[model samples]
Target: MSEERDTAPSGAAAPPGAAPEIALPERVDVFDTTLRDGSQFEGISLSVDDKLRIAEQLDYLGVAWIEGGFPQANPKDAEFFRRAAAGELKLDTSRLVAFGSTRKPGGVTDSDATLTTLLDAGTETLCIVGKGSAWQVRKTLNTTLDEGRAMTSDSVRYLKAAGRRVFFDVEHCFDGYKEDPDFTLSVIEAAALAGADCVVLCDTKGGSLPHEVQAITAEIAHRFDGLQLGIHTQDDTGCAVANAVAAVLSGATQVQGTINGYGERTGNADLITVIPNLTLKLGVGTLPEGRLERLGPVSRHVAELVNLPLDPAAPYVGTSAFAHKGGLHTSALRRAGTAAYEHVDPALVGNHSRVLVSDLGGRTGMSMKAEELGVDLDAGEAATLNDTLKGLEADGWVFEAADASLELLMASAAGWEQPYFRTEAYRVSGYHRADPNQPGQGAHLSTEATVKVWVGDERIAAVGEGNGPVNALDAALRTALGRHYPHLERIHLTDFKVRVLDGGAATGAVTRVLIDSTDGDETWTTIGVSPNVIEASWMALVDSLVFGLKRFEG
Candidate 1:
């Protein structure tokens, strides 16, 4: 364990008669389980390549340890270890720890397949889980309490004898301590006696609160005096991050969690949130001195590898973490900087403060947002743009999630026009027919679109066919602009979302369409609204192409 540090900043004087600041550990070890526990998340499925890439990202973020999966249980995990040992994966700062369970009940560790696989992993450290609760030993494992204790001790002893460091994860530690504190202590003592390097208390059920975790961790830290304690928690109660922090404040030295809180049920603790809290708020260091800035980019990159969208409102790393809206908030932000509305400087975590423009915003918000989009907005232009924004939002046009469209509107307000091709007319037609391959099964539908445009005094008409009207229109527009804008080949639509504003109107309800497009390097969103879905989609699609062209040609 590192030496304690004062919570107060240096050279800062406390008020007279104020209570003394609480001391906290100077550094805490961050153990990341994104590859093992995070893969168990409902929507995440990581291949070997994905795991390798995620491990690289974690290393870049400067986590202390990365838990690879259970090599003995699955061939995929076994192959990952094999490849890692074969020099396919190189870690810069983090140690790759192989994860598994203790030897089976009534089995000897010398011949246990699980222990042998751990030895084969060739890693310096191993983390093995064992039953901690007496009830779980008797009910889940169908074994006596003594055998459960032996399972943990024997596995630890075997791994230690092989010249490898070992971390003992006591499964259900919190519930076990509440039910039978003596039994849980005995299990932990046995692992310590067997030469385990760190004993991690697992909140397997994820129902423990911060107070409970702190008190129990304090008791364990006192009883075992000199032994390193760690914490692993789930997010079933949405308190995993809080509980982990509480344990750290109490006495735990290592915090176990996954990036973005990815796990089986609710999740494990989100290290993205936990690391910053410890570093900035609690005056504890988790990563290397300069590595804290990688948190946001690493969180986003890992989410991308897992094929899951990072939550916009997630603490520290999310897009909305530092976004300011409303008239008063934006006004205060302009007057006092981010200190008026933000807790910490967003740049500390690789994020920047943003001013969100909406109908509820004042002129300050509009001007700030326009500046962020690189559009010069004078006072008159800003006020006009603000009024125009409110009017459009009244008609169901949203620009908060459509920054590309907002940029175009701001540029138009500044007396700039899009230099792309001008649209003359467009038409779409749909047809349906019975399929010859499967009679009476279903009808086959097809859509076709024709676009006419003037590109540098040349009138061009292009036709395109697709499975849907939007797709056909996109194809037709691309065909019409391909020769003039060869860079269009790099632009692609990634996502499309639609929402109805008035359910009462049913078929005649106003529809809002949002299109997400990327040009291999930058991504932007554009939006359109209309009572007709086709017309709304067309409006958004046109904006998407124009925005991409503007970004490229500018």
Candidate 2:
């Protein structure tokens, strides 16, 4: 291989030993593997519908390419491609790419099932992974080195000849390069010779460091001049993002990653973190201009679509990424701006600064937080509120996760009253009945609730039945208020979480209930705590209703 020097683009940070900047191309493709690789995460199971929805989200986020799924893997994946082929799944800026492995051992190119599935996926682009390490090809696949090379070369040649843009993923390239330096380079040479449009060197095991990635990438970039190069790294060593950056610095033109770093094992490199670093920090162009700001919301949207909770500490997108809970940090942040305690402006990624109310918050922090929460507060009142909040925290009230509750508390302290409806009383009962005929169905549980509320002096009582006590209460409350506050129909409880504050008390423990409600346009979380779980749940339920009515009606 030639010893050509490779460096970063002009004004971009140079690699460790590059003499001249390796000028970046006009645009680097941001390929998203969220739908395919993201499903590899434990507890993540996506139906065919989920795959299509995730692809649409990735395209909306301005990804250049979306690896839909492995078409040959299962019926769901194949159906996804079938729907995509029929133009059922629409995309804006992203081209859907089909992912698969190269031709099987001793399989004819014309008759290979995997290759046929790739062609039938109806995607203009296809990404096929092939064993790159000589040891993997020889031992894992039980094939000779020449046959392994032929598998990759033939697959690429066949796909390219069919007019499909083929990108070959050299799986375990770093490990291969370490074991047999010459054979690894030969694998890439075979792909380029076979007319592969782009060659992606994949750190499949994700064990390569930044220095090792840069050194090997420098060599590959120098040797492969005709083909566009890319980097696909995993996160086992926690260097996936760093390795990806190193690869780009060494002249790679494309980056492949999953949103929120969702993939197998430790997961893939996080495109949410990588795009900002590449475009904002490295000055390399990716996505559309100004798309970086939508990253935070996009990350959250993906998590929600997959039914996975967002990691609040996730870089750039997490709720706590720009949240300040300390008095000193909040005070300095307000005085010196976000740069005081943050590396980048939170708004740059569509995230905003948050000052959490806690024992650590001082009067200044409380005043600033009050302003954010739309609660008018003078310095004296802020001091009082700060002291009151500390006292509440000490009493087991967590205001951080209950913003609606905190807002209501602040409004009440500021003499603002929300007298939508007055609840007089409520009663609930549960009964368990055994099924005599259907023994396999177990016991049948039933609940009934009765609620009475006064609206402008007119008291009304309503009875409702449901599967559980909380559900029955919600139904009864809604029934009682349906005629008076018809807008309550629009509000529904989306999530309900319960936590026992005193576990030692066991059956008699004090419990906290957090109720999340949404009224089409917005959502709010309200909390309540009490020794009786029913009482706690009712408090939160009523608060959620009041918060929704106040926002939507008033």
Candidate 3:
């Protein structure tokens, strides 16, 4: 797709602590911060070059602002700001921006050195923090209530007077509003009085309930006629996105969130979910039309840039966001457009409705799903197969979590064709460290796996070992089959979650392992379940290979 089409606003100014309640279809600003706040994830690390590349992609997707990074965090951050200073990062519809805290205690308000540095970075906008939480003031600043207000007003006024466009993040404003409504309102009043452009209420600890968020945001909109109010939520309680959306529904317009919910703790609100939730669901405005369809891809791109695995269950952007399982759900989707299994048209988010068939599929549902997938199925056969699927479920095969594999089983059972390879025999063995390291290294555990496969007249063998038995088996299976298919170059094990369906005595526990893989452009999930983890891994492994073959062969 072409990257250039339109230009985002050169500037948008709002009175502090008010609502920017502009009305328009297909236009709401997505202020992305996957770099600044997203990089705060426990294991996530993005480089200067990585941020630039992601910024370019976000621009192509038509975000309003991409928070480039925290310029003062470390040498790496400072280096990115310095490089970004060249203005080389250009977006047709997105502006590169940076974030930083307001002046620290004892720091001069006018011409503070860090403010100078943030402005000099040449980022189009600056998001700065101002103290709004009473707890933060009393515990961190050791200041009385009046001193905290001075610190906030002085910071905003100084930043605005310095001629740098400023967006004020009222750190922990929601919590403060709950504990000390009067004091929180005072902070907003002060910021608005100081000419700050925007006042963003932040859930620094990410624990606000949705009803509370809606109430507070509504109160702010009603009280602040001359200021612009926004919401920034973290996801400690898994309600950050919900809270942010409720805030908008209650009257707040501007919303601040990371593209993929990256931040300290559980993470910030996920814009990936919020954009469509606001536009298509809540009837609110959003930035750049149609890029909303690219939410899933854009999310995956950011995760990939940060060397992170894509979550299959991530709402709106995960692999399973629009996936339909169970006979009833698939039958409904087949009968109606997203009525049976979904709340929104997945196509609006650049994803197609996925119908997965397995145990629990009814004849009607299987017929509908199969017809939608262009599979040739007779009613009688479909009914019989549905029964068969139910039987398999009774035996403990989880088809919902592994649709790719389930589809292959359906196709094969329906006499589609022969598989390219079949398991003739396989062996996975356990191992332990024979000798404890006495020199420089410590003792370690070991495991081994060997597999043999048959393809008509040819037979191949492969072997591997790992710290875990399942990993070793997966390695061996892939190795045995990889030589014949160069496309298997980068299939990986993204996640392995085990669910004990019949939890009880040792003999009664049935285990299921879910495997997610990617072949570059798209992602797929496979499932395997059995009494043994090694056997479960093999089932999923077989499904992964065969399902990928079907996709490419088509």
Candidate 4:
């Protein structure tokens, strides 16, 4: 195991008579189980390619272990390891770990199919999830507690004998500890005596509170003075991150979690949140120097690969992690920087501070947002625009989530004009066609759009088709503009969101649309609002094009 005695920063000496400092370990291993545990989430389904991509990202983030997948469970996972062994996927800083259960009760360790599959998976590290709860032993496994302990021992011993480093995950450990402390300790003792490199306490039920986790982990740490301890927690009670941190404080040297908290039920402890908390808040170390800033990109990249929408409110790497909206908060931020409203410097995690404009914000927020977008506006103009924004928001226009649209509004007030083209007219239609091959077949629906715009006295017309009205409109608009400005080719609509202004009005209510666009290098958001969904989408789409042209084409 790697070890370094923590010391004060260079050139700083301890004061005379100061108490001897408790030495902190320089590194805490981060074991990411996103591919194994995270894929168990109801909506999550990662292809082999997706899993490989995420594993690479985790390595880039400098996690200590990438729990690739369960090799014995599925063909996809088995194929992933096969490819990994064939050198299709390579990791620089992280060790690939193969996860599987311990040998079956009353089974021979060498003959266990799952154990053999794990060895064949070609990972230097092996993680065995053994039965830890005595109740589970009798009730679920239908076996005696001694057999459970023997399963744990034989598996660890056999794997260790094969020259593979083994980590024993004591599944349902916290509950087992609560019910029978001696039995739980005996299970851990079995793994340790069998030469396991690490023993991870798994809060499988995810119901343990932080205090309970700390006390149990403390006792385990005290009892096993020389064994490396790890923690794995689920978030059913919304305390996974807290419990993981508590376990670390009580002497855990490794953390096991999924990125973005992706897992079954409520998810596991989010390593994205755990990394910063361990290193920045608790003054311990994980990952490597200067890799913390990749947290945002890594989190978002995994979400993108898994086809999961990134949660904007996720802690640390979330979009709103460092955003300020209220006028009071903006005012304080403008005067005192982010420290006035945010707990940490956002840039520390590759995220930037964002000042949002909304009904809750006044002129101060407008000025702050305008300054951020590099729009030149006097105080009087800012105040006027702030009032204008409030009136628009009252009319169901939301600017907080659509910074690009807000910028366009402010710039238009400051005498900016659309340089590319002026929208003359546009129309969208949806139709259905019967399948010709099958009798009485259901109609296949499709959307088409026609757009016309005038650029320097020349009118451009285009038609496009897509799976949806908004997509068809976007395609038509881009077709019209792409001929005149080739730069339009770089802009792609990444995300579109729609929300009804008032649920009481139901179908007749106005809708608010937020469109996110990116030009390969940068992303911006625009908003539109109207009673008509098509009109709302059109407004946001046009604003997105204009913003992209202004920012990137210029």
Candidate 5:
């Protein structure tokens, strides 16, 4: 294996006489199904606007094709295509492809509602899925083998004759080919003979292994010398990405997957992972030149539009992908270089390396983290902070996921005190009482909190009421500090999570609270721990406010 000069994290010069670059494929088509198959993930429901925005992001990332949803199946998908045709959606690099199923078993292509709706979508490219497994034709669709072959051929033929590029998805092709190669090959042959532009082999059940996919794909490629081949795999067996890559190595020119691997069941292959692997690892050109660096930002943007938190540990684009926390790893990274701990240059995929400070990290990690946060820490200060971090972690305080709190701690250790208000005391109380409006229905609960604080020399007391203690405390704290720091109004707590550390203690268990806050411009996390859940929450909440004030006021 050859190593490229790692220039991202440290900006160090490359070693002399590095190995020469390996020869690689020029390009591979990236077909994104995030809007169609990705929508099938549980709890995902995209509106027309969301679909349109996601498409724009994908196009911006420069994928070859974006699979818009099945228009005939839903009004939202229909409106998506209609709006795209009316100039609501614009594309610069990616060509939008409409997704649908082939005509029904006995239906004619010209009169089939599915076919007509696909045509109405007005996309130059159309992808239609059909039964590729003998079992599916015999049992699932309850149709004869001849009808199944006809469905695949007729749909492609109709779309081709109508002046559209057609791709036929051979659903369950892996399993079908394994069970009966002749039958599956016949189905593929039918579609190819009907003028399909490409034949996509799908691991519909997501159970195919990498070796199996490669062998089968090689056979298909050999059989169809001139036709383009595509690979689509799911993650049920956790091999979706591996299978896709294996197929590509065998002969597939196109990869059909979704961003972040969002799909039904486990997920489709993640283009977020696959794209980087193809470009950086295999040296295959998947995206347009220079567009590969947009992968991380595009993945995150789409996740936000879908209202899902992108997995921090996801390969390549995840937040934690290049994060270093272990003492040995951080030491090596600091002394040696980024190549000591990282596989590829994170900048290549639009992500940066992160140094996390925690009990598991050493002074080097702490100093690196402080530098990243723009805080100057001497060796002595970093050593002291590392000791303090371990002591706090022993008491159930976690700082790895709470950067804001960690930064505040480092600043305090560095003799930089926050000029914000100091808390004197706080009190919270809750009550449940019968409501006269709904007699005997249930007890209505209410919480109230009072906070006393000093901005400079003057002390202020404020009281607030809400449905919960945290809310009431936030309201009270805001009431007390809003006038002194107007920027507090912009910092809102977006999410809160509580974890019980000493579960064996039951009611007396120590609790860890993580609070996510946003000030419209950026988001930060803070953490606190205490035996009293309320106190834990209060600690995190206060850190959140102080951090925001420091950023906004200073």
Candidate 6:
């Protein structure tokens, strides 16, 4: 919603009184570095295990190269490469790449400790980078521009002479080129002249515009031949992926990025987006050329592995890619398949389509959702549902990402049976931390829940303690009916989200919580809305656990 819908396949939407022109390059390469850079986002951190899972997913999605992490940063990064060397990875065509800056201003590549760390991490291909500007050479490294250029070429040459595949990451290459095109061009020439496998132009500042990226990358492609070229764009303008695609148009064969667009500052471009653009949009081979459908699943799998929230706005593979929200958009998409608000069917990337229900929904929206749910209802049902939805929204309910709870409500309204565990004045004891020295950690939360339930003539009362109040309540409920459902072991809460519907002058505001849970086979999302965060979470938690229990029983 931030930007307008602009990318048209035929370039037919060009501004009035303007001629359409083909600007995108014919072929491109996709290099995914989500492990290295995407993890640099605010509140984003990926462990070694996270990196390994991402690498495998990227390989499956057809990324040409996986830039593992900064090997010299910490012990975790170093272990990532070591494990990759021990064959702990599952890549098909994607190669594991280790990244580090050049040895030093005047130090030898082999002698530098960081370079040794990069080598020790155990990657076949090494990315040796250096400062790309005269200003950085003098300010950051306190070295002459000539020495910096020498370091660039010398490190690349040293890696190659040592029989390693060396890719030169020209840091600040775009900004430096803008500052002094001749100088930037010379630095890249040094890497090419020194036999580096590929020269990656880095937009370190991430301030380069798309048009500027096109001309500069084209110049580099034109200037350097017989050597592969790559692009490493940052996300300052939220255009890192777009700039990478533009660079491809300028003839860069390889593109580097992180999975899910993880990285420093705003983050790196997403390989998930870039690779498809490479293969499907720009007509280039990224991986082996037939694993395109795995794109969505792989990207999401990595997100789960890293414990990072899947960004709904992520290009090509986000939850919102094929999701319908607005009334007009949903009706059109129903008839014309994504020709309304989307350019591609998300299923092509292993992502399921979604129709979001909100306050703005109309008759068409309700009808579509009912049909998707196999509910053969007429306009009266829609009108009734609309009134019900409006009433719930007024009470701060959100059903967009909370499918399970919404279904239960609909079924209940249609005269479904009452819940098995009818509440009988349940109470949760307030929790007190067990102190820092105790085994529990990170703001300790202990919960004891008391519950009473009845099944026909049999009645039960149980108490349970868990890591949190919600968990404890669910545990007590399950214990009360342990005989009815024994296979309720794997049901778990995967992710939780809370959003305030109205944060007005009121001291306590209305909040909505979304819970994502998975059993053995598929995952489901449920939601609860309330003025109290804890209450909302409990509502979602109960729905998830009870829904799974009912499904198992059936």
lDDT of 6 by residue, 152-263 (tens): 8887887788778888888899889888888888888888899988888999989998988988988888788657888989989988888988888777878888777777
Once model 5 is optimally superposed onto the true structure by TM-score, how far is the C-alpha of residue 126 displaced, in angstroms? 0.9
What are the per-residue Cα lDDT tens digits for candidate 1 across 44-78? 98899888889999999999999989998788899
lDDT of each residue in 1-554, candidate 4, tens digit only: 00112332343367899867644556689999999999998899999999888989999999999999999899999999999999988888999999999999889988999999999999999999997899999999999999999999999999999999999999999999999988999999999999999999999999999999989998999999989999999999999999999998888999999999999999999999999988887689998888999999999999998888889999988899988888888777766666676666677798888888888987888887888888888999988898888899899998887888988999988878868799999999999888889869788999999999998899999998999989999889888888778888899999999999888998999999999999999899999899998999999999999999998666
**Per-residue error (Å), model 5, residue 226:** 1.4
Look at candidate 5 and give me any clashing residue pairs: none
| Model 1 misplaced stretches (Cα beyond 4 Å) | 1-20, 441-443
Clash pairs for candidate 1: none
TM-scores, all models, native as reference: 0.95, 0.91, 0.79, 0.91, 0.94, 0.86
How many angstroms is residue 497 displaced in model 1 relative to the true structure, after the best TM-score fit? 1.3
TM-score, predicted candidate 5 vs. hidden true structure: 0.94
For residue 300, give model 3's deviation from the true position in Å. Answer: 2.4
Q: Write one digit per residue (lDDT tens) for candidate 3, span 308-359.
A: 7778888877778877666666655554556445666666787666666666
Better of 1 and 6 by lDDT: 1
Query: Root-mean-square deviation of each candidate, in angstroms?
Result: 4.2, 6.0, 7.1, 5.2, 4.0, 4.7
Could you give candidate 2's per-residue lDDT for residues 1-554 as a string of tens digits?
A: 01112322344456688787556666689999988887898889998888888888888889999999998998899999999888889987899999998899888899999999999899999999998899999899999899889999999999998999999999999999999988889999999999999999999999999999989988998988767999999999999999999999887889999999999999999999998888767778898877889899899988988889989998888999888889898777667665667766767787887888889978777877788888898777888888999987776678888889888888877887887889999999999999899987889889999999988888999998998878999999898888878899899899999999989989988888999989888888998888888998998998898888778676
In angstroms, the error of model 2 at 146 is: 1.6
Candidate 2, residue 190: lDDT? 92
List the pairs of residues colliding in candidate 6.
25-249, 31-255, 33-257, 33-258, 34-258, 34-259, 37-262, 37-263, 38-262, 38-263
User: Model 6 misses residue 41 by how many Å?
Assistant: 3.4
